[model samples]
Each structure stands twice: as C-alpha cells, then as structure tokens.
Target chain A: MPKFLIWIAALAALIALPHGLSFSQQEILVFLTINVLLVASYRLLTLTGEWSLGHVVIMGVGAYSSALLTKKLGVYVPVSMLLGGVIAALIAVLLSFPLFRMKGFYFLIGSFAAGEIIRLLWKRFRDPFGGAKGIKGIDPMPDFSVGFYQFDFFEPTSYYYFAGVVVAVCLWILWRIEKSPVGLTFHAVHWQDKLAQASGVNVRAYRTLAFAIASGFAGISGALLAHYVGTINPNAFDIDLMVFVLTWAIVGGTATFYGPILGCVVLTVINEVVLRELGLEQMRPLIYGAIMILSILFLPNGLESIVQKLTKRRAAGGAPERSPAE
Target chain B: MLDLLAQTGLNAVYAASYISLVAVGLVLIFGVMGVINFAHGELFMAGAYAIVALYAGLNVPFFLAVAAGLLFVGCLGLLMEKALFRPLKDNPLGGLVASIGFLMILQALAVMGFGVRMVHIPPVTQEVIAFSEKVRLPVARLYVIIAAIVLLSALWYFLKRTKFGWALRASAQDPEAAALQGISITQTARIAMFIGAGLAGIAGALTAPLVSVNPHMGHSVIVTAFIVIIVGGVGSLEGAIVASVAYALVHTFVTTFWDGVLADIVGLSLMLLVLIVKPTGLFGSADRA
Candidate 1:
C-alpha cells in the first residue's frame, strides 16, 4: 500500500471506531483529533525555527473567515472552509517579508504584535466578524451530501469522524515533509541558518513558506473547530488562545513531529477532564503557568527530549560524559 | 487644534513614561541574564495589586504603597532568580519557559486573591492642569513623568559611575569576561532581576489607578513591552528606552486622535517599518536576536 493509503486507512479506522462511543468520549476524541491537526500545523513552522507567535491568530483568521463566509455569504461549507485556509496562508505570505528578517525572539515578538493587530482589526470592524458579540448561528455541517455522500456533523460521533479525517490528512502531509528534502532544508535553516545560507539555501524563501504552511494548518484547525462548536468567537484567537496552542508545542516538545500532538492531546484532556472536575476554571491558567515554569527548569528540552534521554539512560546504563573539542 | 496637539503631547509623555519603565526593565533583565522574563508583566501586575491591597484597601498613602510595591516585586524577582532562573541558567529557553509558568502562577494567585472584576482605585487626585477645557493633564500623570526622569537619571548615573553599577554593566556586556575581571555573575543576576522587576512594579503601581486593575491587566502590558523591546533591539538599554518613548508617542497620539484599535494597528505598523528600514531599532546593535 502507498504511504497515503496507510494514512487514509489509519484515519478510516479512527472514524469507524467511534460508532459506539459515548457523547462525551466522542467530544474528547474530536478535540484531540483537531489538536493534532493544529499542533502539526504549528510544528510545520517551528520546524523552520521561526517561533511564530502569531500562529493562533492564523487559526483565528481561518475560524472567523470560514465562519463568517458560511454565515453571511451563505457559501458552501466545504468551499468556505478551504477558502478560509487559503486566505490565512496568503495573508501570512504577504506579512512574512517584513516579519521574517528578525531571527529568534524578535521574530516571535513581531509575530505576536502582528497577531494582536489582527485581533484588534477583527474586533474593530464589526460588520464582518460580528464585533465583540461574535458571529453566531453557524450551520453545523449539513446532512445534505455533495458528490462524496452527505452526512450529519451535528451528531458527536459523525463530527469525530470528520475531525479524524482532517487530522489524518494533515499528519500525512507533515510526516511526508519530515521525510522529504524540504524537511532537510528546514533543519538547515533551524540548526545552522548562517551555514545554510553560505551553503546556498534560499533561507528567506523557505522561512516564508514554512510560515504560510503553518498558517494554513491553523486555518484548517479553525474551520474544523468552528464547524464542531457551531460558533466562533474572536476571543478564541487572542494571546490567551495563542498561548493555549503554544502550551502544547512547548510542553510536549518542539524537536519532532509527534511532540506537539502528544502535548495537545494530553493537555486538552487534562483541561477537559481534570480541570473541570476540580472546579478550577479560574485557576486553569495558574496550572498552565506552573507547568511551564517547572517544565523549563527541569524539562527544558521538553518531554520528548526528556523521554529520549531516559530511554538512552535505561538502555545504556552508564557511560562517560562525552565532549568534543570545540 | 492647539488643544488637541497639546493633549496628545501630554498623552504621549504619559505613555512614554510607563512603557519606558517596562521596556527598560525587560532589556536590563534580558541583557544581564540572557533570559527573557515572560512574567515581567506579572511583576507589574503584582505591583498594581500591591497598591490594591495597600492604598486601595488599607488606605495607605499612595506613594508609600508604590514604594512598597517596588520593593516587594523586586524581592520577588530576586527570589525567582535564586530559585527558578538560576537553576535554569544553562538553558535560556528553560528560564523563559519557567517565567511563563510563573506568569500563570501569579495570574492565578491574583485571581484567587482578588476576583476578576475590574477594581477602581479612587483616583489619587482629581486635580488637573488645564491648557484648555479639553486639554487637561491629570496631576497623577505628572507623577509618572517626574518619577521617570529622576529614576532614569539615577539609573544612568549608577550605570556609568558607581563601582557596583560598572560591575553590573560589565557583567551584562559579557559575563565570562566580567567573571575574569572579578565580577560575580550570580550577584549581577540578582541585581538585574531586582532592578528589572522593580521598574515594572513601580510602573504598575504608578499607573494602577489610571487603567482598569484586574488580574488579567498584565496581558496588554506584556504585549506592549514585547513590541517596545523588539523595536529597541533585544539587548540595548538605550535602545529600549528610545524605542519605548517613540512607540508610546506614536501609539498614544494615534489613540488620542482616532480610536484605541487603530492606534494598535499603527503601533504594529511602526514596528514593521522599523524592522524593514532598521532591524536593529533606533539605538540597537545587532548582537542579540
């Protein structure tokens, strides 16, 4: 079977298994599925070493764009969803030229500032995004099937399947990049940008492309979220939201493709299950912040790296600390 | 038109004062420690809440509360360095991530201590100096400006003249070399944390009454600080101050004439323009990213 077939089959299994799942279980599955897509999308950018802070904003753009188009313009849901991702990616590309120059934290800061600006813009223009009140009454995925056969998305299990499909496709795309030449270039830009530049990499172009791809994924996630939740709020795309997405990548680890999905799924579950039970709605951020601090101090390289170290330690038992002359 | 310009000028100066305080601290901490304090805004929030606890609740003198706020938050910074940032010194990202955690902890504590509703501190004074009926300068704003001038001047003097100040600057400029020259990196880190967190605290204490005081107020302040520092360049003290003043002026003036949202747009556009024309900022050198 082709690699794409494996991806499709994997996703199909995920979708089919939800047939007998409970409502709450289905919701959890959908959220986790969407988070995997979202995190992978974000990983696409971080893989290039850009540290794009505006990533949540790109998701916001996607969520709000598709949500608005479907609500007001009455466009087909699938097309609007695709359009949302496309618009967000296009905007990211246009903004990337001015933003991509500053390396490291400056790029992060610039992207953050841009995200704030976009958020304010969305809030300021009341006609389109429904102002602070937010656009409501989005039609959840309709049962009227197109050529692919219609299905009901309002039911929790069906939505999970929808989410699962998207996640599968995104994961495939991301994994392919990881194994491809572009992934090699991404490492070149990340680990040694100066050396890569000297070695004839179009460092600027690649960074821009990475950013656009990341934004595109965020858009895809946003669309999925809007369809699932049936409403989109501007508040969902601000710093808090941005930080929410970032927590996954940071806590899970940023060094590999699997880390962010691991982070998103773990945290999202914790948020839904443990946090709600504890009645710590107001203190959720406190928990998040504390985790961040402890993670930095003890797990600086993040959980993925930590796991690798542990596995190596358990496997090797003991070895002399190795250092090469710099 | 005259009144409008003068009003904008006053607003600009006020914005410049607080933002410069926050930005300068951010730079100082980043310079010395090689770690960005994501919780710097939380320090500012802690300052404001120090006032909320003291001046607003206990009816302490405003200036006294402000002083206490500075000292308390500065001490908190020292504690953070000793406990958190110091252990993670080998990993700057670790330090930064730890700070982010601290930011959440602080926010949570604030929420638990004080509910999330906006707390209105009775204005320190209602007195205003009038250029015209609409062109009024609140006496409270004058306090921020005067305090900025005196404090910044003293900081400059200390940085340029005093032996400890020289040690601090030396350590900031190059820690390994400073260590070779007999300066202690650990001591310098303590000093930087205290000074940096103190500035943010004081800025917050002074401005607490002007804006809505809430647990989440640190959000915008940090965002503003990030923009200022990036515009000022990562590691330049003078650049941080200059960029802060310039950004505040443009943002405030635009906010005053137009709306708050548009001003934000313009503030970011200014950042973009700076990045394009002078990526190092107005007074920045390009060593730190």
Candidate 2:
C-alpha cells in the first residue's frame, strides 16, 4: 500500500513538474521525457548483449518517416507517428539480416556501417529526405481538450504532459516485456547463446525481436522530437548524439531496467540545468567526458547501485519484499 | 581521359599512404591491447594541432614540427594507457567507453584551444612533381608517401627482428601463455600504444598541410581507417595496408568519375559486402573474430 502511494506521488510530481520551470527548462523537460523513452528502448536492445552504434540513425528513420508521411501522404500526425515506428522496426529487421551474421565487435562495426549507409542515402537523395538540410516545417501534434484541461501544442507544458503520458505507457509496456518469458530468453541468449540454442530457444530470432522492438520505441521517441522541434537534419542524428545515448546507458549501468533511465535523467540534469546555470556551455562536453570516465572508473555499477544500497538499508529492519516494478 | 586516370592513380597512392599509416596504428593497438581506441582519431587530430601550434603559429621548422607532433600524440597515447586503459584492462568495453570519453576530452580541448573554424596552415613547399603533362603529384604528398614507406618498414623491422617486437607479437597471440612465459604485458602495451599512436600522429602531421586542419577532421580519418582495417581483417597489419590501397583506389576513382557522396556510399557498401560475405575480413583468420 505504501509503495502504491509512492507510485502515485511520483506520477503526480512528474505531471506537475514542468509547471514550475522557466520556458527553456520546460522545453528541456519535454526533451528529457522523450529521451527517457530513447534510452529505455536502448536498454532493451542491450539486454541481448549487443551494443548498437546506429540507434540514433534508427531514431532518425522514425523522424524522417513521420515527417514525410504527414507531409507527402497527408497522414494524420498521431497516426503517422505510429507508422513511423513500424517502419523503423521493419528497417531493423532488414538490417538484422546483414548485421546479425556477426557478433560482439563485428556487430558493432557492421551496425555502424549499415547506419552510415542509411544516412548517406538520406544525404544523397534530395527528393524525399530533403538532402543534407533534412525536412523542415514538420506537422505538429494537433491540440485537443478534455473537460478538465485543454492541450495547446504551442506550449511546452502541454507537450510535456502529452509526451509524458505516451512515454509512461511505453515504459510500462517495456517493463512488462522485460519481466515476461521472452525477456528471460533475451537474458539467456545474452549470457550463453549456444546454451540457449541447445535448450530450443532460437537465438537469432530473439535478438531480432529485441532489436525490432527497441528500434520501434526509439522511432516513437524520434517522432515526438520531430513534431516538437519542427525541423531536423542528417547531422541531427549523427554519431555525436549516439555517443550521448551510449554514455547514458553505460554510465547508468544496464543491470537494472531503470538504470539507463536514471542515467539519462541525471546526465540531462547535469548537462542542461547545472552546466547552463554555471555558464559553462563551451566546457560542457569536456566536463561530461570527465564525468563518464569518473563514473566508469569509480561507480562502475552506476547510480542505481547507490539507490539499491539506500533502499536495502531502509529495508533491513523489515521483512524482505520484491519491488513490484523494477 | 588517360591523363585523368593517371592523375587519379597518383592521388590514390597518396591517399593510400596516409590511410595505411592511420589504419595500421589502429590495428596495432587493437592487436596488443584488445580494445578499439576510439580516441585514435582525436590523437590524429592532436597531431595536426601540434603542427598547427608549432609550425604555423610559432614558425617552427616544418620537419621539426612533424617530429614534435609524433612525439606529442604518442605521449598522449601513453597517458591514455596509464589513466584509462590500464585500470580497465579486463573490460574491453569499458576501455572503449573510456577511450570515447578521452576522445571527447581531446576534441573539446582542440575546440577550446583552437576555435571550431578550419585552421589555415601555410604551405610547406610549392614544388609539384610532374610525371607527365597532365599528371602531377605535390612535393608535400611525396613527403607523406615516403614517410609511410619508411615508418612502416621500420615498424615491420622492429616487430619481426627486435626482442620487444617478439614479446609484443607473442602477447597478442595469447596473453595468458605470454604471461606464463614471463612476458610483461604492461611493457608491451605501452610500446605498442606509443608506436601505434605515433604512426597516426605522423600521418596527421604529414597531411595537415595537404588537407584542412580542424578539430572534427579526425572524423573522416577514423571512418576511413575503420573501413580499411575491417576490410583488411581486424588483427592483420599487412592486411590493413593492402586493404587501404584497395579502398583508396576504389574511392579515389569513384570520386573522380562520380560524385563524392556516391563514392562514400560505394566504399561503405563494399565494407558491408565484405562483412556479410566474410565476417573475419578478407585476410583474417576465423579465430580472431
């Protein structure tokens, strides 16, 4: 019952959180909400023990598809977002045919190559992808109203609330997937693919499944960003952005479901709030790099390990219970 | 048409020289340390910056600036070994992550020290060698080619003939057995890191005059090196050189005939094809992958 109340309180805080921030911080909050989805989806792919360098490109796939569908095909903004995710997933499946042939290091490089090819295609073709400048004047999510409150697409707070709900539902689905039997198979395949294969689990199929699902969610996050930002370019989803995602996942420690999300939130706080306040915008990458190195060296288990210790200490005097949500 | 082809061939040879230098460094570091040095491109960038500061800014002698670039970037490699790679020795991924962090730091340093714009370095020479009426190779490019041949041959000699070279190769083959045989992994790692980084540094320094020197310039160098190393086989030095030549020939010819973007696509597609057809690379043994 107490845990349930805690969940309610957390939800309430998230819902009300953007109201207090300045216009810019509220904008950051919206981006933070979308990034939580991006990093969380990234964690899903990592569950199968393969790190992909092309995840941001897959996200770009979503952004491009969503923007194009609405502009060219006259699809509704919301429906186009879903279709964008589906297309991203389909692309992942196709990439897996060439990518899954190798494992470990080879997989990393191959995925990068595949992603670069996709980006190059986007750059080479000016017709659909708008060449290097990418698509501009993207359709925004149409505002709607309920009895209690009206959503204004122009306001960051409204977008924040809408994105928050969508991301929350997505996170719930991801959490459920991680807890299911398929999730266990992902873990099995990661730890020992041959053993998993011997036990009747199709290793490659599970890997592809994880990759597809992860790409699907990443695509959704990209769509959310596109509608909000109203513009994107090929450079928007370059390796630099991918590096941020990679650092978030690694620095957050991928042992637990919430690790990467926690990493994303904390790092975003540091990068956006603290550094911006300090007027250290130019030194942001330097400081962030230092933080990544320090965390890996000293806090290899990540911030979650710290959270676990605090929770464990509090629970020492009481009966042990598994947390309902990971 | 024949003149254009001849000129393109000369351009490919010059491209091959610098690319092999960078790719061989990457291969050497991966061979000895079992970690992909993501900061390698930044090290190459640092080398260019060294020449920028010394030769361009301070008006230092050109060859002296090149040597200083090699030593400076090589020392940076040692620093990475001591501060980052050494502690994270057991975890290859951790080392890679740390190298990425280091890469960011290097790039930030470059940006802070020299703003984001392209740095214009004065020409080292004005002489161009004329093979024919239509074919020409600049003296600066000749410097790069000569340096590549000499440095690579020296490296080959050190690896095949020297005691330290033998120790390095043995450890690369099997760290456990090498350790059992009383080989010092730390010593070999340092030496390999130095030589590998020095090679990349020199490549950058030698080419700094030929290309636009900028902080982000390493991006393309690293990408080309990756394609070359992967196509040549991950752990093979000779394969890296051969692959570098082949890739340069294809890329240069394509760029000459078609657009640069299509050339990039073709090069990347060739890499993908090799990856799909033979995951171990063209010359790599199966065990390495």
Candidate 3:
C-alpha cells in the first residue's frame, strides 16, 4: 500500500513538475521525457548483449518516416508516429540480416558502417529527405482538451505532459516485455548463446526480436522529438548525439531497468540545468567528458550499483526497497 | 579524359599515403592493446594543432614543427596508456568509453585553445610538379607521400627486425603467454602506443598545411581510418596499407566523377559489403573476428 502511494505521488510530481519551471526548463523537460524513452529503448537492445552504434540512425528512420507520412500523405500525426515506429522496426529487421552476422567489436563497427550509409542516403536524396538540411516545418501535434485541462501543443508544458504520458505508457510496456518469457530468452542469448542454442532457444530469433522491439520504441521517441522540435536534419542524428546516448547507458548502468533512465535524468539535469545556470556553455563538453572518464574509472558499474547497494542495505534492515518497475 | 584520370590517380595515391598512416597506427594499437582508440582522430587533430602553434603561429621551421607534432602526440598516447588504458585493460568496453571521453576532452581543448573556426595555415610550398596540362602534383603532396613511405618502411623494419618489435608482436598475439615468457606487456604497450600515435601525428602534421585545420577535422579522418582498417582486416598492418590504397582509389574516383557525399556513401557501402561477406575483414583470419 505504501509502494502504491509512492507511485501516485511520483506521477503527481511529474505531472505538476513542469508547472513550477520556467519556459525553457519546461522545454528541457519535454526533451528529457523523450530521451528517457530513447535511453530505455537502448537498454532493451543492450539486454541481448549486442551494443549497436546504429540506434540513433534507427531513431532517425522513425522521425523521417513519421514526418514524411504526415507531410506527403496527409496522415494524422498520431497514426504517422505509430507507422514511423513500424517502419523503423522493419528497417531494423532488414539491417539485422547484414549486421547480426558478426558479434562483439565487429558488430559495433558494422552497425556504424550501416548507419553511415543510411545517413548518406538521407544526404544524397534531396527529394524526400530534404538533403542535408533535412525536413523542416514538420506538423505539430494538434491540440485537444479533456474535461479537466486543455492541451495547448504550442506550450512546452503541454508537450511535456503529453510526452510524459507517452513515455510512462511506453516504459510500462517495456517493463512488461522485460519480465516476459521472451525477455528471459534474450538474457539467455546474451549470457551463453551456445548453451541457449543447445537448450532449444533460438538465439538468432530472440536477438532479432529484441532489436526490432528496441528500434520500435526508439522510433517512437524520435517521432515525439520531431513533432516537438518541428525540425530535424541528417546531422541532428549524427555520431555526437549517439555518443551522448552511449554515455547515459554506461553512466546509468544497464543492470536494472531504471539504470539508463536514472542516468538520462541526472545527466540531463546536470548538463541542462546546472551547466546552463552556471553559464559554462562552451566548457560543457569538456566538463561532461571529464565526468564520463571519472565515472568509468571510479564508478565502473555505474550509478545503478549505488542504488542497488542502498536497496540491499535497506532489505537487510527488514524494510523492503521499492521495486524498479514502480 | 586520360589526363583527368591520371590526375585523379595521383590524388588517390596522396590520399592513400596519409590514410594508411592513420589506419596503420589504429591497427597497431588495436593489435597490441586490444582496445580501439576512439581518441585516435583527436590525436591526429592534436598533431595538426601542434603545427598550427609552432610552424604557423610561432614561425618556426615547418619540418621542426612536424617533428614536434610527432613527439608531442606520441607522449599524449603514453599518457593515455598510463591514465586510461592501463587501469581498464581487462575491460575493453570500459577502455573504449574512456578513449571516447579522452577524445571529447581533446576536442574541447582544441575548441578552447583555437576557437571553432577553421585555422588557415600558410602553405609550406606552392610548387606544383606538373606532368601535363591537367596532371599536376604539388610539392606539398609529394612530401606527404614520401614521408608515408619512409615512416611506414621504418615501422616495418622496427617490427620485423628489432627485439622490441618481436616483443610487441608476441604480446599482441597472446598477452598472458607473452608475459609468462618474460616479455613485459606494459613495456610493449608503451612502445606500440608511441609508434602508433606518432605515425598518426606525423600524418596529420604532414597534411595540416594542405587541409583546413580545425578541432573537428579528425571526424572524417577517423571515419575513413575506421573504414580502411575494417576493410583491410583488423590487426593486419599489410592489410591496412592495401585497404587504404583501394579505398582511396574508389573514393577519389567517385568524388572526381560524382560528388563528395556520393563518394562517402560509396566508401561506407563498400565497407558494409566487406563486412557482410567476411565479418573478419578481407585479409583477416577467421579466428580474429
């Protein structure tokens, strides 16, 4: 009953949180909400024990598909976003044939190569992709009203609330998937592919499934960003952004479901709120870089381990710690 | 048409020279330490910055600046070994992340030291060795080609003939066994890092005056190097060189005939093809992958 109350309080805080912030903070909140989904989806892919460098590109696939569908085909924004994820998943499925042939370091490099090819294609084809400048003047989410509150898409707070709900639902689905039998198979594939294969677990199929599902969620995150930001270029989804996602995953630690989410939130708070307030805009990357190195060197297991330790201590004291799913 | 083709061919050779320098160093480091140095491109950028400071800013002799670039960047590599790679030796992924952090730090340092704009270094020489109306090779480019050949030959000799070279190769093959045989892994790692980083540094220094120098200039160079090393087969020095030449030829021709963006696409696609057909790379043994 206490756990349920905590969940209600947290959701209430999230709902009311953006209201207390300035306009810019609200904007950052919207992005943070989207990024939580992005990083969470990244953790899903990592669960299969293959770290791909092409994830951002797959996200781009979602953005581009959604944006094009709305602009050219006159599809509704929400439906287009869903189709965007489907397309991204389909692309991941196609890419897996070429990419999954290798493992470990080879997979990393190969995925990068595949992603670069996709970005170049976007750059080369000016007709649909708008060349290097990318698609601009994207359709925004249309405003709607419930009995209690009216959603004004133009306001950052409205978008934040919208994105938060989407992310919360997405996180719920992801948590469900992770706890399912399929998720167990993914873990099996990650730990020992040979043993899993011997035990009738189709290692390749599970890997593909994880990749597809992860890409689907990543696509949704991209779609959310596209509608909110109203612009995205080939350069927007480049390796620099990919590096940030990687840093979040590593710093947050991927052992638990909430690890990357914790990483994304904390780092975003540090980078956006703290750094901006301090006016260290130019030195941001340097400071961020130093933080990354220090964390990897000292906190190699990531911030999640710290959480785990605290939880374990609490459990030992007879008061059970909160479940990560909550 | 033939003259144009000849000009592009010469251009390709020059491109091949500097690319092989960077790719070979990356391969050497990966071979010995088993860690991909993501900061390698930043090291190349540092080499260029060395020239920008010494040769261009201080008006020192160009050759001296080039030499300083090599030494300075080589020392940077040693620092990386001591500070980052050494402690994280058992964790390849951790080492990779650390290198990325290091890469960001270098890039930020460059940005702070030399703003985000491109730095214009005065040309070392304007003399063009013209073979025909269309075919021409600048003396500056000749310097890069000659230096690549000389330095690579010296590296080959060092690896093939020297006792330290034997130790480096032995450690690269199997660190535990090599250590058991009394070859110090630390000593070999330092030497490999130095030579590998020095090669990249020299390549950057040689090409600095020819290309626009900037903090982010390493981005494309590292990408090209990655493609070359992957195509050549990881851990194979000879394969890196060969793949560099082949990649340069294809990329230069595509750029000449089509466009730069198309050329990049062709290069990446070629890499993907190589990866799909042979995950271990074109010249790599099956066990390496």
Candidate 4:
C-alpha cells in the first residue's frame, strides 16, 4: 500500500508487457511510458504555478542535442544524455532570468515563446540534426549493466521495462521533491506568491529550480526516446506533444501525484486499445472527445480524483470534502 | 528581387487570411470564456475534414458544405462548453486539460472517418490573379483573403452594434458584473464558442483544397495560433487580428526568402522580441496577464 508498491507493480507490468502486444502496440505503450515520465515531470513544475506550454520543446532540445552530439560528434550515448539534461537545465535557468520578472500568465506565455524558439533552432540546423528528415539512427542505447543481469537494449520488452523503471525513478524523485521543504515553497508560490515572499521564501529561486528540474527530466525522456527508436524526427518534438502532455497532467489532476500516471495510462489505453480495436479508423476521436467531456462534466477533479473517490467509497460509505493534509 | 518580393507578398496575404480567422476565434473564446482553447486548431481541422466528408465524399454543394462545416464544428464547441468547460467553470486548468483530451478524441475521430491520408477537397477555382508574369495569386488564396475581411468585419459590426454582441463583450470583459446585470455566463460562453469555433471551421473549409487536409493538420495551426495570440496579446480579439497579419507577413517573407526552417527562427525571434518589449503582446493591455 506504499507508493513503492506502485513502482514494483509497474515493473511487473513491464516484464509481461509484450506477452500479447504486437510490435506496433508495444511501441505505442512504450511511447506512453515516455509520456507518463514527461507529464509527471511537467506536473512537478506546475506545482509552483509555472505552467509551461513549451516543455516538449525542451524535450526536443534534449533529444536533438544528445542525438546530434552522438551521431556527428561521436560522443558516448550516456555522456550525451547527461549533456542533454545539463544543457536544458542551463537554458531554462538562463531564460528564467528575464522571464522571472513576469508573473502569472505572462510567465507561461513567455515560456511558450521560448519553446517555439528552440523548435526553430533545431529545424534551422538541418545539416546537423537532419532538418525535417531528422537525424537517422543515432548510436543504440548501451546495454544497462547490473551485476550479472545484462538487459539487451534491442528487445521491445527490455526497453519497455527500461522505460518503466526510468518513469518509476523519476516519479520517486518527484515525490521526494514534493515532500521536501522545496515542495512547500513551491506550493506556497502556487497558492499565493506574495504571501510566500512575505514569509521569506525566495520565490524566484524556487520557481527557476522547479522549471529547470522539469526540463532536465524531460531531457532524459527525450534522450531515451531517441535512443530507443534509433531515429529522431523534428516532428516528434513539435508543440503538439507539449499540449498533449499538458492535457495528460491536467486530466490526471495536477494537484495529485498519481494524476499523470492515470491520465497517460487510462486515456492512452482507451486511445489505443478501444480506438484501434474498433478500427473506428479515423473516427475514434469522437470517443476520446466524449470521454474528455464526460470526465470534466461528472468529475472535474480529473481521473486521479475519480480513482481516489472510488477507492475511498469502497473503504467507507461516504467521502469527506477536504483535502487530506500532508 | 521584385518578383521574389511579389511572391512573398502574395504568400503573406494567404497566410494572413487563415491565421487571422484562426486567431480571431482564439481571441473570442479567450475573451468570453477566460479559458485558452488549446483545441482551437483541432476545431479548424474538424472543419476541413467536414468538407472532405460532405463536399468531397458526399458531393454536397461546395458553399453549402462549407457552411455545414462551420455550423457543425461550431456546435461541437458549444457541446464542449456545456459538457466540459461548464462543469469545470471554476478550474481553468481543468478546462485546458479537457481541451487537451478533446484534441486527442478529435484526431482519433478524423483518423477513423477519413483515414490518415490527405483528403482531396476539390479546388474551388483554377484561375489565377496575375500581378505579373512571374508572380500570381491563386483565386483560392483570394477567397481566403476575402473571407477573412468579411467575417472579421461582420464580427466587429456585431460587437459594435448588436445587443447580443454587446452582451457577449460585456460578459467577457467582466463576468461578475455581467452576472449582476442578469447576463448569463452560460449564454455568453455559448455565443463565444459558436462564433469562435465557426471562424476556425470556415477557415478550415475554405483552405481545405489549398493545404493538405490530414488528421494532424491542426498541429501547426494550433502552434501558429498560439504564437499569434501571444504576440497579439492573449484575450484581445483585435490584438489577434493585427498580430496575425504581422506574424504572417514576417513568417511568409522569411519562408519565401530563405527556407521554412529559417522562417520559423525569425518568427520565434519576433515573438521573443515582443515578449521582451511588451510582455502583454502588441495590443494586449497590462491587466489581462
């Protein structure tokens, strides 16, 4: 019943991931892992009330930077991954200097613009990143070495488990941050920045750190995706992905830790499992649209809250109205 | 150089038309509902695909099909409000998340209904308006330009003259005050969604034959719409139009002169420039942020 149980269960799910899934289906679910990791990371930054529309752009920066460095400059994959995260963090921190002056929605808009700039730069450097065609066949992800258990990087189930593990690790790191004093500062900023500042919290410092940390994890997701697919396309890093992740985090319930996992898993499974099976072909969006509408209509608290209510109702006949305190 | 400039100018006109239509709808929704409709581009895509189904597949009259596309997508927006945004009224973030979910649903539906391939929305005209031998504008492009002018003007007139339009604006500017005066938030949101979505739909239907009509086509427009809204200043209807033209001109000219890759750079740089100088956007007032 601990959070660690969820991580263990996810790891078990990954081990059996490919039992029935086709190569393509496994591919989509793996992509969902990437989405889950990034969405959770995105929710981390959103805790401080710094909503970002350009996080996917940060992901692209990570993906392309690691990709191009390894492919062209002959850098090692692990080092390249580290470099990607570091660069993204540096960029976010530097950009936050001027952007931190703006409060509320203005900061959000500024970040969106910054993301567009990143996308443009990637496309502009066609020779390096393969432009629209994107860099093809980056160095394969090195085999993860653990004592005597060597996991092959080429297997679908292996990568699925790898993605699962990474997501779980990221989730734990995010959980740690949420429980840390920094988390309190972030929630304070989100709730009331003026009050937080009056209480001597360095609002700007915590805000920048939150945004940078999210970007760093996004970089990891991007790097993993690039290495997993062995191909990188500019299209994959487009603004639409950011919007999708934002939706996942929100619908999952940004206020709760488990919201994104539910948003990514449940919605994705529906999108894939139902939409694909019905072969509603192109018409599957109606089902998705209907679900979103209904989710918001009947349960504005998002899917996470729905899960909470269902679980609570089973435990007791009625649910309380207040948030359970930390 | 003259011919190249001429071509870029014509390109700007077409870009401006479509961008303005999409941006205006975005502005209208933002103004009234106080929620940024992330699915605005998908609504636009739905409009184009509507044309693909009715006009191209079912052989409906082109103009009537276009109108149907507008009305249908507009209804979809209204449904979104009643079903999604209305219940999450106090939570803008929830509305946003709902929209994100809505986008996936729309994209999936398009894939089911139309398949993933680009549907052929028959060209309205093959004629070209020649500015010179080396430079000409397609009649289809002109249609877009004309549509932008007429639709935007009609919107302005309605806002300036009509009772309902005033009611809509009043609700947008101050919902609580409007509520005090007996103007229903639900009614105003419905009106805003209809017009906002109708504009995006019509834009899609009109440009269907001109651009590739695929399930993912909304992706670019949404980003472009965001950039335009940001540059124009979010929640400002007039700001959207002016910024759209400015963005289109800059985007088209760069695209024409260099490559799309470079043009994107210049466009982002322009957005960044605006952010540094006027964080509220060119026309956006300080309070909206």
Task: Enumerate the candidates' DockQ scores in order.
Answer: 0.56, 0.59, 0.60, 0.52
lDDT of each model, Cα atoms only?
0.82, 0.92, 0.92, 0.82
TM-scores for every predicted model: 0.91, 0.97, 0.98, 0.88
The C-alpha RMSD in Å for every predicted model, in order, reads 4.0, 2.4, 2.4, 3.6
Answer with 3 or 4, whichever has the higher TM-score: 3
| Model 4 C-alpha lDDT per residue in residues A212-289, reported as the tens digit of each score | 998898888888788888888777877667766765766677657888778888888888887888877556666766
- The local distance difference test score of model 3 is 0.92
DockQ head-to-head 1 vs 2, winner = 2
Scored against the true structure, residue A263 in model 2 reaches a CA lDDT of 96
Q: Model 4 segments beyond 4 Å from truth?
A: A1-33, A72-74, A144-148, A160-168, A273-284, A310-326, B53-61, B287-289
TM-score of chain B of each: 0.96, 0.98, 0.99, 0.97
| Best-first order by TM-score | 3, 2, 1, 4
Chain A TM-score for predicted structure 2: 0.96
TM-score, candidate 3, first chain: 0.96
Quality class of the docking in candidate 1, CAPRI style: medium
Looking at model 4, give its docking quality level: medium
Q: Which digits, one per residue and each the tens of the lDDT, describe model 1 over residues B140-252?
A: 99999998888888888888899989999888877899999989899989998999999999999999999889998888888788778878877887888888888888888
> DockQ: which is higher, 1 or 3?
3
The parts of candidate 1 lying over 4 Å away from their true place are A1-28, A144-151, A306-326
Comparison by lDDT, 1 against 2, better one: 2
**Predicted structure with the largest DockQ when compared to the true one:** 3
